[model samples]
Target: MRDLFMQAVAYTSMWLAQREVFAYRDEALQNWTLPGGVEEVQATVLAKLRVALDYARSSNAYYAGVFASVGFDPLTMRGLEEISVLPIMTKDDIRRHRSDFEACESMNSHRVEGKTGGSTGQPLKFSMSRDDYLRSVGIGLAGWHFCGYVLGDRVGVLGGASIAKQDAVPWHISRSDLALNRRQFSAAVMDDNRIAQYWDYIARWEPAYLRGYPFALAELCRHRPKGCAGHYRPRAVLTTSEMLTESDRHIIEKALGAPVFDGWGLNDGGASAYECREHIGMHVDTTRAYVETVDDAGRPVWDMPGRIVVTSLTNKAFPFVRYDTGDMGVLAWRGCKCGRSGLMLTQILGRCDERLNIGGVRTEACAGSWLTDIDRVRRWRIVQDGPLHITITLDVDAGFDKRASEEAVTLSFVSRCSTVSIAFVYAPLPLPTDGSKWRSVVVLDSARHQTRVVAEKHA
Candidate 1:
């Protein structure tokens, strides 16, 4: 009875809030529609950058002082090419001068305190203003156009993101999730019975669009308890937070009966990118931020995967100019066949912390294909605590073997690194109380190194 009452309250509130959600969809359409192709995109990018820079310099004391020191003027930038003249920054730089980063007057309109889980294991707190918050929603709504989704459409999110932590109501019945017409089920609580219950909920809900962490949703589809393949196929499936491999994409699309649209973004509000229907490459939100790749010498590169640098264009409350997000990827020069005329990032390499530095091995070689064995396990997380000490946690299924699993993990590492002591913890995997979880690999024994990367549109 209480559940029904909450559902009633949620439905009524969302009906009242549908107007705002519709407006957000309309605004996203207006913001995303670039009719002029490449030239138009370039013009819009230049104009927005110019305006954002001027506003930051004029209203932000920190930027004002920094610009004066370098004798830099935002007004002088005639083209996107001029962005190169600005200095690239990192999270530490933002923290050291955190107080100086805000443009208080303009930022106070919709300010809310924000913090990042820091995928690289370094968390940071910051502020999120009105436009800062809404513009992200706008981009996400816009991306759904590719999925044939509009505001007020049913959206079911399957994850234990902090958004699920709201006290107002159950995630599926919350007014907040109603924007995409979203109904959410917690990924944090998972086991045979709970998963079966989730399957029952989803079968009944029959959402139009599905969104969540890749592993969470994939496992649900993988282990739907034999006879629970409900006739509920969504129009699209959206994955985010961590990297999405081609193999993962194919498996998900095949199992869920929906095309997958992957996205990437930083928790610090630095960058955002999403995959379109084409599924070839992700289109970066050039309107919200600028993405650039640099070589070992810090010189910009167009094609190769190098250190990625992100500059946030919208967040005046916390401007991230050329901030290193500590994830690596290659940047492509040409336009996507989907006809979107903007720079795109491809081949996302996980964080610098996730990189195997000892064997001087590439990521694919070191991480191996353990994820390919998703059929045996429900989910997996690996944390490298020390130079040679590692912890492997798994939420395995009925047929899962402890001895075989240990052998697989140990072999994957021993073939790559020596003197590695492995600890296997087989228990139900817990979802983060915060947002999306990152940093599956941690090297606590060594000083932190930096790199760059992106987000899922829903991130």
Candidate 2:
């Protein structure tokens, strides 16, 4: 009876949030239901791509100018291979011409604002129309459905400030959480006391499944309370936002007694791929984005690993066409053995950088959220040389206010780790060497402290 009641509340909350989410989810499921072989599915996806391309060519200002300059017309294009004529878009391009990327027709639609530091730790603010935002959510819900997660099943989400802010509340549970039958745990603060509190909440809540960053889940496993796994066990664990290393996967599985399902996606609403029950590789979500592998020169590559490029299908508000994701992956031409078709990524080799941990707390990508809307800041980097000391280097524009930004940075870190020391360094931050993805947070000797945390868990 309680389960039925929670499910009812979940459906009600989802309806209140977005009236069309379920419809979008149904639309996304069409990919799975498409009749016939792989070629048929590919044809359907390319049809959508054709629509997206033509929309950007006619609607988006940036694409309009680029299309004119290159003399490439999606309307005149004969085949999918012709898409290669479009130039690959870099992060710098979007950073400079963000406004021009928006479709002129979507100006009147309500916009949902978001920001990401991306792989380079350079902040970029983006938005999508209300309909596009709901579509993205629907597509994500479809992915969760593939993982055997039903809406309204109790879920405990462990995430950063972006997902669940570190509020003043003791349990960090919010009203919206109750409405959806979800519990929120802070990934920003994982000290011993907080970890203990999290476990207590989990034991009582007995969530049907748990979802969080790989590092945060690994930390929970390392310091999990005695016999905590005995009292309750989740059906499955979902991990995302960071690379899920094999070591972390093993640790989490051993601690929780459930299979760890990992996925990869961009915050920009561009592309996403999730691991099905097959556990072989992530299935490219063709319903939301079109993904492919390409060489540095924008030519498609299939025999070897190459840069991952994406074109968003749902987000017409800010069309991302031929957008270079600054990540490396290999696309398998074959379909999954699990009988699912369309697109599948054999591997994703991106965001492979060390994490910053002060004591038991490990910080991920939430730093991007902290620095959002700051006008003076251009690009930023976080470096940890000592255990409790962090230095933030910022590349500022003219008329930068050091005092205000410094206070903001200090308060952000100190709120998560009260004992940590914060310092500021101003300069033009260095670039990644030889086309490598930039290491956002650099920890000089992270392994030493990481080992200590595990050792203390045993003690």
Candidate 3:
């Protein structure tokens, strides 16, 4: 009875909020998997691209000026191949001309704001129309469906996106979350005790899907209670936000007793690719955004590694044409084993950023993210130059607690890699002045003794 009630509430709320997503999701389920749907999908993409170009040229000042500067008109666009003539857009361009990117009519209207938890440590903020937000939600739901998830299904999300830790409670659920059958588990510094608590919740809740960062899920698998495997298994484990490696996948799948499905998407741009059951490669959702790979000179490449570029066809309010994602991967025009046709991001070679590999356990430097909440901590950076040595640089206020902060930072890393040593350095302001994005996590190349100094703008 309780499950039925939650389902009713969830679906009813979704219908009231955005019924169009369901419609699109249904169409996607058919078009993405059908044998002859590739041609139809391609036609739809070209039609949408044409409409998008026209809309942007008239409604967006930025694109209009860009088209004028290039002496290119949207009317002359004959094929998707012709899109290459337009200049590529970069993150720096967005940062410099954010206002001009938005549609002139939506400047004063209400919209949704999106900020990416960038891997390079520089957050990019953008706005989306209410309609586009709803469609994106629908598109994401279709991806979830590929992994055997249904609407209103219970999901245990273990990520830093939303911290749910209370003083006594390891996990928290709000009323809305309960209605939607969702629970958030904090991805912050996890020790045995915390992992045990998280596992306890998962065992009780019996979520149909486990979704979160691969690194956090692997930590949970590493510390799960003995004899816990095969006792409780979610339908599938959906991992995103970080690169999912084979080793991490093996660890998570072994402990959870379920297959791991890797996903990649841009938070700010809404372009996505998800793995189907066949698991050959992630099928790109070309219906929402146009995705392609490019060489260093901004020319398209195939069957080989290059940079990933995207153009959001759905985001009319903030149009992004040929936006460089600063990530490297391969885009193949091959068919998947799942019968889904169109484009597939065959490989994700980027975002395999440096990690702290100590005592045979590798972990991300997301501890620096949690430090932002510490009292008097203005900014922080984590640098790993040796296999067992880590230096944390803190730019803090006068009231900072050096001993307590060190203890907190130490616990975060030592809890994962017990053999590593932690040190601290105080800095007033050490940001680069030559206009370069700074990364919070810096991992030096021990082979050549070269430090990859990642910049972080002092706030």
The model with the greatest lDDT is 2
TM-score of each: 0.77, 0.75, 0.75
Q: What's the C-alpha lDDT at position 441 in model 3? A: 65
Q: Alpha carbon lDDT of residue 37, candidate 2?
A: 52
* lDDT of candidate 1 over 272-362, digit per residue (tens): 7778777777777776777788765566787786778876677777676667778788887556777675677776776755665433333
Regarding TM-score, does 1 or 2 come out ahead?
1
Instruction: lDDT for model 1, please.
Output: 0.66
- Rank by TM-score, highest first: 1, 3, 2
Q: What's the CA error at residue 425 for candidate 1, in Å?
A: 11
lDDT of each: 0.66, 0.72, 0.71
Candidate 3 clashes between residue pairs 3 or more apart in a chain or in different chains: 438-455, 438-456, 439-455
Off by over 4 Å in 1: 1-36, 102-107, 166-172, 178-180, 359-439, 446-459
